[model samples]
Target: MDMYIRVKRSKSTYFIRCKPSDKIIGIKQKLEEIIDQPVSDQRFVLPGTGEILEHIKTLADQKVDSDAVVALTLRKDVNEFEEVNIVGPNDFYQSRDADDANW
Candidate 1:
């Protein structure tokens, strides 16, 4: 069966088409094509619950259903991964307005 997930970051949302049996790493591989970030540098979390998805785990194993919202965080330095920072649409509008003010 085909399922899709929404992977979100700051001001960016990637609608990834996947299967329930797919490993978390596989999804990260797909994301690499779009974001150019290696799987080692990427981390996925369940939005709200903050449950970290393991690379060896499948979507079904993690109870991730169709249309689930997953937060994508990247490694900042050496040891720690950055916090989830999915920006909303309003932020874009506000930032654009702020940029216009500078013009």
Candidate 2:
């Protein structure tokens, strides 16, 4: 029950994968900690849509028993730091390789 998350914007992207059993709030918190910022202070994205859990429902209906890929990205441009923190020109976690080893 792992999840793949992509936090990005026009210029950058940060890809993160975690167990779905891990709370989304926790993931947000961890990313904030990694970037030295707060979750609310950053942009909130839910993959294909801004609405969270859509990925869950979409996959569930398809009977896909695989990890969820939730791409969280900013719809508009944010400030430089905010962009860098959330999604900037230098996001270091892009094109991440999937690691099922955690499971």
Candidate 3:
């Protein structure tokens, strides 16, 4: 079976490196077109919990390809940026920028 994956950054999307793939952009664009929504919606459920990993739209002029696992990072209220709070089964590690460094 062919596996489909996406790793979204800030505003740009990094497509996973899947074999038998002619081009990543083709699939990405097709998916985007089909979804009629940003790739951010492509989320997966955290095992054992009800947490979801939502992809953020990445910037353009960037390179993203397959093999990149876009993980679901925890989100904080726009109001609170210091106080840490866990969201569902995110296994969320408090990060000032969600860059893997958990406080």
Candidate 4:
């Protein structure tokens, strides 16, 4: 069955038509394509619990129905930029400390 869902971001709202059996990651990928954001950086907020929707689940598994509103926010790390300390050209790999593993 096809479901129409409303995705609300900061100020923009997107209307998407999907299937109940569709994976959440597929939805995130579509949103990423439309909004120029990466799927890894996207978070879908649940209505009641304020919980994030997991990508492994399908729309039906999440109890998301037709005309459902799915709130979206960027992951915390998405907006955060880590400072990189560049050493010599050949020492780039060694320059990063253990604390900068994420970088």
Q: Give me the candidate number with maximum TM-score.
A: 1
C-alpha-based local distance difference test score of model 1: 0.95
Question: How accurate locally, in lDDT, is each candidate?
Answer: 0.95, 0.48, 0.38, 0.77
In candidate 3, which residue ranges exceed 4 Å CA deviation?
Answer: 7-20, 37-88, 91-103
Query: Highest lDDT, which number?
Result: 1
Error of 3 at 61 (Å): 17
Which lDDT tens digits does candidate 3 get at residues 26-73?
444555664464443333333334334323323111222334344322
Clashes of 3: 12
TM-score, ranked from best to worst = 1, 4, 2, 3
What does candidate 1 score on TM? 0.86
> Between candidates 2 and 4, which one is better according to TM-score?
4
What's the C-alpha lDDT at position 73 in model 2?
Answer: 38
- For model 1, how does the per-residue alpha-carbon lDDT over 1-103 read when each residue is reduced to its tens digit? 9989999998889999999999999999999999999999999999889999999999999999999999999999889999999988776565646667763
lDDT for position 51 in model 1: 99
TM-scores of all candidate predictions against the true structure: 0.86, 0.44, 0.25, 0.71
